[model samples]
Target chain A: MRILALPPEAPPMLRRLTSGLRRAALGAGALGVAAFAPQIARAATVHVTVAYYSAATGPYFKQMAAAFEKTHPGTTIKIDVVNWNNLQQVLQTDVSGGVPPDISIIGTRWLLSFVKDGIAEPLDSFMTPAFRNRFIPVFLKPGEIGGKVYGLPIAASARALFYNKTLLTKAGFPNGPKTWNDVIAAAKKIKAMGAYGFGLQGKEIETDVYWYYALWSYGGHLMGANGKVAFDSAAGVKALTLYKTMVDQGLTEPGVTNYTREDLQNLFKQGRLGMVITAPFLIGQIAKEAPKLAYGIVPVPTGTVQSTYAVTDSIVMFKASKVKKQAWQFLDFLFTKDNRVLFNKNEGFLPTTRAVAADPYFQDNKQLQVFVNLLPKAHFAPVIRGWENVAKAVIDAVQSVYLGKAQPAAALKTAATSADRALAQ
Target chain B: MTASARRAFAPRMLIAPSFVLALFIIAYPFFDIARMSVYHVSRFGILGGFAGLANFRRIFADPVFIATVWRTLVWTGAVVSGTILVSLPVSLVLNENFHGQGLARTLVMLPWSVSLTMSAIVWLWSFDANHGMINATLQSIGVLRQPVQWMARASTAFPIEILVGILVSVPFVVTIFLGGLSSIPSDIYEAARIDGAGRVQQFWRLTLPLLRPFISLAVVLNVIYVFNSFPIIWVMTQGGPAEGTQILVTYLYELAFRLGRPGEAAAVSLAMLAILMVFTTIYVRMQMRSAEP
Candidate 1:
């Protein structure tokens, strides 16, 4: 037995088994190294989280991410889509939990509070002069707070007077209203046609925004030069009076107090409403959902001034993000000519970049061009810290006037008082 | 270890994870909220230093908060009483020897299975001003000349909200009443009938007395649930039309999430907790008294 062991195998079967075992071990070692080799060679991917609202624009974001990742290898973009109504609460929760996204698209009005709270990182360092000059100057105003740029306007919107052409022609007004008086007169005629004339949104979310269209058109500002509540002025009363008169004259649906923006848009799409002051996005929705309904888009009918509410969604970098450089790179990639145009086209928002705005793709679109023309006359909502409370107060005041619970002046005064208190806080 | 000690240790070890989970989930949050009630927490959740009872004082001083508290009580009372009134008769029908008793029970339980948010959404569509089923039916039947916007005005919105609360709460309330009815011995009803008692008399003396515990449980639970209910009012109206439908819970939500004043929200929460605790204590006392032989 000792002699057989020293010779390594007494039988051919034993020798064959030993050779097979050695081969298997070598193969296993080679496979292990091969599996780990790529992991060792490639650097760890930098993940950047970007939060945005709008389910409609989610696909464009995904496309943007794919394009960005193709150009920048070893970097990934995580898109967090939140509902617009819950965006603030979700972002606040994320911030309190110490896990805010690397980048986010926030409401333009929220830029001030975010900066004050140190939630937004100043983009002055990341923004080059060329890049700074790329955005429309007026569109960038809200993003700048206290002499620092905390956000970059990614998407911009200006409210337009969208009219159901079929309803307008049936009401004997082939052309849509051109002035506030004409709108009121046309609304009465439309109401006589057994359909609601003007679809008014009076409830939460964009209630204040709807109010702003009339307020800005009537030459009212939310705050005066001294930073006191200014919506209680004469212009504010006129704005509120316009809405009350619409309701009183039976020009709007009886349930204007509860009508949401979508509710009004739906009525417009169904041809039950003659006119509505809404964003360009409603055009896309109407075209898709109610293709038979002929519609017209125009600059919102003027009061004292021919201005519309202009709101922008801006891309903001968070201070807590470890991938700030990568996030900035992705933002730059997103603002490219083709990407910006496609994104704005898909969203029905005006292009924020000057180059994209001047491009033939956006310039040639008549409906979009209407909004682009109105951009110079657009007025942004106040971007103060407590503007949400002010917005709430404005909504309440307008609802009170619409519901016949208070006079426009009294309601505006009460709203101003409440807003002043909120601002103080 | 001794056998008794080993047995106790084994059970404790088995329960340790769950006990820790409960402490983290319930006890920790409760204590943290209590602490926050007295401190000034900013919109960003930074502690703005000790504020003592300033938040509570501010809440108490606010007329809106006072009105919200009153409105919450009214909502809770209306919802709980309405639920009991509806569920009692439904449970009586359910307890009968019907052919499709099992099917009836399951069908009635469907509303409870549907999420509150989903129910609110469904109700919103049904109560829609222009194209809702309710409005269309009312108009077709000549009950309404013009469609009423159910969620627009405070007067209509409040009643509609209560009706919604009753609809959602009836399933669970009916189940509890059914359980109570089943547990009562048949012989007791027989004995009452033999003693010359009628159906109404039997219900009052025997059925109702036996169902006291279940009724108390239902009332207490419904009180808590309705008082703390948020999504229904939130989804339906968002406490709008000049904050007419603003209850304590919705007000607290606005304060915490919308207004970004967590400290005041905590105070509001603690105030709600105090009210609930009082009701719970009374419920516990009644339950203990009922348990006596």
Candidate 2:
């Protein structure tokens, strides 16, 4: 259409118009490709859904997901942080609904149930000997149900006696209690100083576990060789009586039946409680929430044996998950030395891996050292079906005894029956 | 289309969406629950074939379930009756010509506007043995020698739970009663007065009979709501201190969600539904009777 030939370099406006058209065409082409890029990438991307409980540590999960995505390129990790109280229900519901997440961080006690239900994927194929050896054996043992590894311990905690150092000193004890009797005596002394001597969690959720710390200390077990509840033994009665005596003597806080583990921790953090038995998570919380309050951690006072509750949350892959390999990758990423150390340090959980535990970050800390040393002596709750219901029965019995509604021997006997019933169910 | 055809199809077309919605939302789930009640559903919700009436038999045989049923009945009766009693007086006061009457009516409705969980939490704080306002005030005034652990003991917990239920429920009942009170013509009261009726007589003879429909409605609705109420007991006591306050709904929740026994939970739900249906039938009968001349 060039009726009139122009110079090689045309008018400024015309040059600009040609260049603009060229740029627009290029931009359109680029935009078209850009628009389809995500779709194409998404087709290749492996979507892994990770469900865990830690409302407080949600941001850390997002960070971990982002880090995983960045390194893995065409992969995505979706994180769901369910409330700890509702994790089991939600996970079960999700599993039943056939839309379960690819990976789930579940209570260690649930591993057997999940395995028995056939929803949990065996991770032995993914976990090599080197990788298996990386984890602390005790923490890893719960994840193994019947010689098949269904889960990996992602976070763990060992219950220990947390004493308010200032309160203990104020009550004429410079250090923490050395024995159960010392605890009672110090508690009485602290109560005289206008603070609760012992903060007992008599409520449902962890009440049974708290009772176990005492029960196991007295060399009692939840089940015997025949797999029946053996908690009605003399040791169990003694354990219940210990708590009952403390409450009756006004050494523990009033309304012990209403106190949750967290509530007791809060009371202790406020310097109003002389001693509490809880996990190492409280150390981080107390350091952050109550920095001015000095505290000490020790193994739970021995009755006939030295024992504490060792609780672990494990990560397992769902059998229905399509991206098992990618899920394993993320799981492996989570337990890597640096990530494990950082995550545990931030989340106030004990490291599941030996490498992380051996890190100076955990070694040099005196408060964490007590819990770390107690790990070997820690006892997990019986990993039996209907343990939750059994625990509820024990909680009821303990609460009744604490409230003086029943005698320890009778309550323990009844609780034992109830536990047996629950086990049989 | 012909005009006749269009007219004939119009109503059905207009109602089709809601009908389908009701089918999916209400009928489907209800039938599913009914089916679940007859089967042995596992923890994974796998139906383990027909269990016949075993679930129902087991629940009925269980002493705890029997206790829960009785508790549920007691909870419904006490809460509904308490609501009516408290609301009737407040609604009457609100209906009268008085200073701050509008403000009083609004204030009376405040608790109704708050969600049950929020109110339960507020009440939880108030009933805290050591730091709750009720305990603190009672102790300060020497009414309590020590801070009584209200929710920690079954005896005290049950009453406080009922009281909290009434607290949350009374506002709704008051508003309903107020609506009923306003609808009654003043002329009837005037006529009663002209016939030598005192204020008490006028209220007793005229106000009550005329408000019968509303009172029945309030009672029926309150019965359902209080029967199905979960939060007040859950947040306050968690049906605890030995499952003392565990009613039908909380027990169902524990059975289904906590214990992972959907079949048993569904049985409990069906039992609850049957009991509620009886009340519903009575309410409908009363409504029909009231509607007639």
Candidate 3:
């Protein structure tokens, strides 16, 4: 028989573990002091975290950081470039850890949450009339919430149809279909020719947006006047039903749920798809990858009203920053007319500033002009908490309908319920 | 100290350091999650006022969570059993001395060297509805008139995911089997053969009983790994074409990151830990009972 208890020798072993732990703690404390040493010596360090849009995004920010540092002595701009996929999670972690950057470029949709959390510094006090007027009014509207400006639009784009010119022309709509009915007619004709007709996106991020184009056209709003979800209403069902009908008729690409926006873009580039709706960046992609593909641009095909979705990414100063002044200076430097033009040109984003909009490079591009013209009739994603939840619910519902598992009305009702539950949380 | 007391406590003294390390590594997270599970945590990991059991109630109420729990079980069972079935034959063949044995072993372990994300990505491209190698090959071979959108629905996507899960798990399981095979003394088998035990009889009566411990280890470890597996399903389909292919872990990730509900996600994780604990306990109990005379 033996007792299961520590003997006299165990105390020394315990002392060893504690001593080792003390050494590790001392080492960590020394490293912490080393990390803070630079903070004490430097006059000010403005850390800016920007999302990577393209290969050019990092270098462009680094150049801006250098330029800003050169103009203002005793200040340093440290630009941290993060991938778009990880941007939100990184920001969430940073914000929670109480070490977020002085500034960040975030999706405008996320600005609502940032503002609610009191993490975003209100920009109203920093803006002069001249400085505010530098931006296009429509582009700036998305960054404003509850009568307070919290962010500045860093990049902007609106959606429109990119049609295969050869197919649409043979199908008797050379300039592309102008309405939902015309789209059906053109798609039917294209389907008769043994290729995909409409290129519908159903799998990933923008699956809900594809359906929303039709929803907005048919006079559906994401929320009711009372601020409850309204996309489950009649117009929304009609919009989804129309897409389902097209899928059933084989007028859109087969297995619509298998295709993402990128997949549809690929089909369009391969000249096997008649039409697809996407943002302005596809213009640059086409010029690079499929220069001879012969495509044309048009507004998203109308249902009862002409409508398209506009989206923007915003640069916001953090309320937690110790160096807000220096961060604002960097933002101002980056948003100058010439700098904006360079950024838009390099990243294929639409001009967010009035000065850059007048640039000849944008004005002369016929394909891009179509997207710019659609701005008057564009709808931005509504500023609401839990937008991702709404988006997931919508994506799931749309995919189910696209996969022919549920009827449009039934799926939309279920989604509205799920979305409401998420919003409540 | 007395010699008898020293013998018992010496082992405890040695284990104390590692026990403390395990507490830091595992127990801290378990405690943190347990706290979050009962609280109203914000999207960015901030704790609000206590909301006792709200997160767990929310998860239980969610239809997707219910479905994901069932699917996770299926994913673990199918992948683990399928892996054992495939690996047994492969490891048996590999156990025999043969020409190019090292090359065959290296080829079997080749996928293990590649990152799970990379392998999942390669599989994703291969199973793409169009312009994918599998679709192209199938079309060329006249086996399929049109390409199947393998990821468009759960029916095709989940099976393919299970198959990939099996493929990746095979190497690990086979290695375990080979180790077990090596441990069985040759003299025992020789004695059995001399006693007129045939190949089938010898294998059934000798090889299987000897391999019981390794098989149990493979089953337990693989269940935990595959149940929490994210990349293969996530990179391939992101639990989509709808949430049809969702398992609990993937759903937890979507909740924590995508939907910004870390509180609920913490609750889900605790539920997962509880399930694994219960399963392992029952499994070990059965194994121990069977081992008893």
Candidate 4:
């Protein structure tokens, strides 16, 4: 309660007014407490903030929440869905404002910062061995920092090359290009036939990830043992040079720097581009929007090593949560086999739970199986703080290279220096 | 107290409520940002130990910050001056007692009613390389053999953004100028004609001098608005294609949210606030001095 007392030296009318205001304040405060009493005394609400993966995300979570509420009558669930682009900003504001939700779905790359800031609650003690065994280890590893688990994998995905079969057949490599050289050769032939050979994504979110497919394929790594940026190595330059060459030779679509990952996918769906690399969610998008498109999946083209980028978004328990027990129970119920399978199927994400992986829906899907088989050779984002800053630097470098403003080696070197400075902060 | 002082105190007491509201609304955030700029803050704005001037030093050392400062100045100057030059002729024509003047005025101000972000998105689509109306129109007129990639590089993109800035800013300036025009009473042009002044001379001598205060007001307001404009750059190019189109406000956004360095972002913002304050002070003082007898 606020102290509304006036000083003893106040005049008669002022003191009278102050006392009257105090009485009014007391009356309103009493009414406020009365209004909130039932909320505090009855069912507890576990508020969850989730990222909108698709239109189905909100309704799917609401359905899960309702089912959980029915099973556990004493606890209520509240779900708030945010777009992926604004999730980080919203969470930061909510956390700093001291009203963070009980649970949130956050990018796995951000787990380190949350752990470092003591905002994430470690869920190891809350988990029994059976609960621990439910998750596939690879998917679970990203949410663990040091020796404790701070998040549970809610969704996981990996990237693969989605090649237009018709265009590839016309270019005489019908099964899709298996290597970078093959891609270039097929692209040249496709360009002669009045279509873009490769759909290069040179803009916006995941632009750096798109390039990392090439970098990892060519045996480059993100960070060294000392936790410094090492992407400026010889292999990194070579990988970038390969893309720059493609851009220069007109093998890619015109105005390559204007093409985001979504733009490239749109081109591929229109049959104007021969190949693009993207996640499995494109399969769902293609089915809904471009049903007549004939496309085949392949692993990211091979350089020195065949690799893909695996990523996950996880549900984390915040340290600020008051209803920890109820929140943990909700989390436990949400991760059940049926719930996992439903979420995976609705969002077109790869399975994160062991039981969901073995389900016939995922097991029988051939296009999904390609992504699953590539998982063993997938490279996750390195566990480091300030990874977004590094990605921004790399995205800038890649954009400049594609735009022909700077050479690949100089751009990578400049990016490495700036990224290291950002990482140092 | 003296009687005159007491008399002064009454009006001050009457204004106290609104004054306190303004203080709470404006000064609190100003003070908060100032404190954060001087302190060591975490990504989520948790203040750590006091680290004097380190945040300022970091931003000063950044090449992007320096480059963005100049770009912001260019953006402000171009947009503000462009708006004034465009609105002078527009408001002049609209002020004439011609038929359909109301409809013409409404058409000129239509873009103002649309939100800035919406206009930016429409322009983004308009300038799209593959399927934009601008390119189609140009190609149809036989202006080019190929469609131009307008947003691919900053060289073309920044100028287009400035044009859009000028377009959106014209309506408000024209409104101010129209108010100024009507206030001229229409008798001044008659008096100038009696003195043998030509039409251009009357505009130069009478119309411009009477419109001085309004021009100053428009410039000050637009400089502040255009300098802090976010969506025009953010929604269009996102200060991208290799940081080529970045301005201070957009760069500050990138710093605070994308890079998660709210402390340095606070420093950048405080720097921006100081710069605006200095500019407005100097400009207003100059205007006041030039207007003096």
Candidate 5:
């Protein structure tokens, strides 16, 4: 009867009352849930932070984060971009401060130390059997410590020799050197042609560590089965002697001792160096910054074995992270074939998954494929707990040897002694 | 309360906030660093079990640490002496009532206003081996055919750093000396002239002695600043060209941050702090001696 004779304002009031009643019913339902479980009363958005490198790779990560948020409506993902020089310190400080990013791209060489410190959470518990089998085996090795997986490789890079094609041709070697002896001969030829035969980072850790890539290729072992410094072995001494001879022969730049990655890259771009052993990730940067250089990427020259240093970037969860589940969700999403293709495409990273590497995007890329081919032959750095100290000692000794202040045998001995002492610490 | 009590109470209140500030700003960090220095903290800065004197022993045994200490001393000495000697004349010129004295004074102090890192970058570009402005200018003037690789060579790298340090620090030194010069009444110079004292004699006997306090203050400041300098040396060479440019601060930064040897870095920093305390003690003594009747 009231509806039959309803005033115009009464209908509006009735509509409002009905909507308010519905909201109150929903609120009571939510309160019922809260009363049943107190934890639900404090339910909050789980914020996960993921970090990556590569100025070009930041946007892809953001897109991945967006997709992850879309898939899980209530969760959020944060992406942090770090430059190479500061990444190690930033990660160290965060983990050490007990407030690490939920997931981060840690250097493969840095994983052992992080794992040893108990800062990296073992991902084995989270990874399904199918997920574990997706990546290349070498890509899996860096994140493995004591047979426990602490990280999962997302993007990878490998070191190889880059040569100036025109310079190599002028030096009577149309193709890049395939062996150490040939490299030296070609370097000397280039030196005679008024160009630096080679570019090497003789000053910093690059001297000791990068040269080890060459040494291992020549059947050298930095640490023997006993795990002591074995750089004084026959192969180690030969590797060091060859390096010193190149410097003495004026086949390398006089200022080689001062070169870092930036310096080496610039010199190569300027046609001052015939060849440099650098990572495949540099190709994209070179193409962008100096597009005119006629260059070739080949396998790192061999001594007796075909080997190269493989660097992997892995997404590691922090031990203290509260949003680890969300972090894993984001990590799993990142390695899916489609996302991996986008990530590896713009970033110049080799996809960790063999299937992703075989995608049409990477299959036809000749320069990129050479690096892809080397994936099987790649070896990771030593996974010792105190590898940083050992690496620094070895670098200092190499510097001493290169500067002619100490003999190679003595320097390597000192390095090994110090390294052993550090390992003990 | 009586008027005297009220005044005393107000003064105490005025100083109370500062005391609280001192506890938070100075005492807290001092005690923290001291605590960290003695502990064998892991690279992650978490507390590992204590090992007495282990870190100090490790630091002493490190050749790079020893080299860095010597380098820090050399850098401090160079910056202090270079800053004072150069700025002394600059302040003298500025103190004279010459034309454009205001502009000259401002220009002399301009570098002090720029941050150290910015100054380092500017100087680095000027000193670059190839395509640097300095080299370009020198080449245009037919000074040399080949550009000098100023930062690449071991011998030139530290010298270049020292030169830049001197350039940045001289402005502050000159300004402080100018203040000292101004406080000495003009009548003193007039009296010396009237007494038939030559300009050289007056400067050595009168002006030098009068400026001693300022010189001591500037030396202490310069030494502390130059010894603690990291950005300039780090940006230019990063203790490189075979660690030729390494000073104490850069060495500590590399060891702690780059090499992940916090224990060694902390030990070296404590040793440096000990050295600087000695410098500060000596400075206080000099100040006391100068202030004596």
Candidate 6:
């Protein structure tokens, strides 16, 4: 009851508090500026946050950035590498949050998904008639969604059979496998020599898709042109049977169910495997990780026709970009013959430009020549919206069959039903 | 104002910030997720009109989803029970003052210090079929003539994943139980020893009953964490060997993130949430009962 209000004489105290508050705010502001100085400086660069994948090709990317900035005065390219495995999710989050990169390089297979979601801007408006004619036809196919070109084809990775020359020599084959049958036969012999015949990834959808690439090359398309799930066809059955034959013949490891690119690479590096169907980029990894082993590359062996899986990286502009023209300019500069050659030659990827492909530098690089030769015969996976689901189903189906969880026919049937449903959506 | 009104006002004033924060952080997302569970929202934006309960219904009818739910239950059950069973004894042992007991406790908690993804990868490397340390060690010791493809076989993958889960989970249980063990008065153990109680009987009669709160806490936490664990299975096998290791969370991740089926993913998330809620309710009931005099 005796507690009296001191309001009449509180003005002095209030003034002191206000001054303290002002001083604190100023102090905080100063600290904030200091903390953000590097970011402010970083913002002035082109700031291309490329998903940081590996230390292997990082220097090359830096050189490309430096070269791009040098050619275009008053511009600097900043590459932000995201983890490769989380690249799609990171890009999606970036775009969804309205903080998308000016230009994002994404897998060709992902183009349709990004476009279908309407996050990716169609590049046709940016591409002049002259520039539109520059891309390889198939590389452009995967980047198109709903008859609109949504991305700029930067580079394509055509998968091929990379074999250990010493293993082949020890097996008395002297030369690497040529045809699918020859590969299978050579695999059997290689296994007899206490080495894995062929490193086939049979665990996940990604692993299974590699097998499907070979299957499709053997005249077994998963979905026929008529839109029926053709993976259950006679050709499909034949392809599965060939795989089963290989597994039974000790041509592949008994524990092929969980095999992955890393496992296959490890085996090849250790000289415990004869060959694996993988991308050209893995060759550089091998050269760095295990240089002692002599290796050879051939076009992916075919059964019915010559075909290898082609995955490309495309420069996709976000629909939310404030500067679309600048984004296009950056992409055009990156895709030019000179820059394209420099990027591809340094990155171990085959260039998307025909001129870059025909460049004497690529022709001279024996490793580059293998991918370049294969690109002509390469088949890009069907890139319709919901194709990711189809790919997953296909991968799962292959894993199911390999694990003996389901027969090839049964697995394919399940996959076909799921894929058809996904595609039909 | 009356004392009751003043008391009410005081509590309300105290809780106002928390209520507002919860409204912004938790309640908003909770309701949004509830809405998303039913509606078909694309990653870019809402594409279609209301699907009503179609997303939920689709999740139930889908075989892969059903399988994933079952696998999730199995994963949770295995990891939780296995973590409790393995950790209780380790905790009890460490409770006693023994030589290097502190070091042992630290070593047990070492796996917890590492991230789940890193632990899973290390385990994956160890569980490698060919040149893995486990296989090589086993073969060198003449125990296993040939290597076992731990992650390859459908039959073996679940157990291996559970093993990894248990590895990450046990330390938490051990740490919790250790706290409980320390809290229990030494007088109780002394009284039990005077009553001619052996180690097993002492544990069964006194230690366990008193540590019921800690046990329940550990179990409840393990169930929720294990149910939602994505990285271990995803990194090791990627829900493969034909999706044998495809738990609900991993499957939902693939559907939403990998396959771009946000609507279905949202549905799966709600279903998994409902499941965890039920489990939590049961746990709470058990805890309440054990807490009674």
Please give the range of 10 consecutive residues that has the lowest summed lDDT in model 5 chain A.
A1-10
Candidate 6 stretches greater than 4 Å from native = A1-47, A51-56, A70-76, A170-172, A226-228, A286-292, A365-370, A374-376, B1-3, B45-47, B192-196, B290-293
| Per-residue lDDT value at A163 in model 6 | 89
Interface RMSD of each: 1.2, 1.4, 1.1, 1.0, 2.2, 1.9
Can you list the residue pairs that collide in candidate 1?
none
Please give the ranking of all candidate structures by lDDT, highest first, separated by commas.
4, 3, 1, 2, 5, 6
lDDT of 1 by residue, A1-425 (tens): 11222131123234334434644555664777566444433532233334443455777777777888888888766565667777778778767766566788888888887888788899999989998898889888888988999988887888899988888877666778888887888888888888888888988788878877888888888789888879888988888888889999999877788888888898888888899999888877877899898889878988978888888888898997767788889888888888888877677888888899899877789998888888788788777777877888888888878888999999999888878986876
- Interface DockQ of each model: 0.63, 0.54, 0.65, 0.74, 0.40, 0.60
Q: Predict model 6's lDDT versus the native.
A: 0.77
- Per-model TM values vs. the true structure: 0.89, 0.89, 0.93, 0.94, 0.90, 0.88
TM-score winner between 3 and 6, please give it.
3
lDDT of each: 0.83, 0.82, 0.89, 0.90, 0.79, 0.77
What TM-score does candidate 2 reach? 0.89
- Considering TM-score, which of the candidate structures 3 and 4 is the better prediction for this target? 4
In candidate 3, chain A reaches a TM of 0.89
Candidate 5 lDDT over residue span A1-425, tens digit each: 12322222233234345435644555775777445444332322333333445666677777777777887887766566666677888777765544566777777778877887788899889999999888877788778888899988876888889999999998777888898888888998998888889887875545666678767887888777887867777787777777888878878876566676768888998878899988877788788887998999889999899988777767788887767777787788877888888777777888789788779878888888888788778777777767777777777766666667778778788878878987777
Q: What is the lDDT of candidate 3?
A: 0.89
**Each candidate's fnat:** 0.69, 0.69, 0.73, 0.67, 0.47, 0.67
Identify the candidate with maximal TM-score: 4
lDDT of 2 by residue, A1-425 (tens): 12222232343234335545644555665767566434322422233333443445777777888899888987777666667777778776766655666888888877777887788999998988999999888988888888988878888888889898888887777779878988988988898888899888988688888888888999988888999988888899999899888888899998888888888988988888899998888877876888898888878998878888888888888888777888888888888899888788887888788899889998888878888888777778777887777777888888888878899999888888766865675
**Model 3 iRMS:** 1.1
The CAPRI class of candidate 5 is: acceptable
The CAPRI class of candidate 4 is medium
Best by lDDT: 4
Which digits, one per residue and each the tens of the lDDT, describe model 1 over residues B86-138? 99989998999989999999999999999999999999899988779999999
Candidate 5 docking DockQ: 0.40
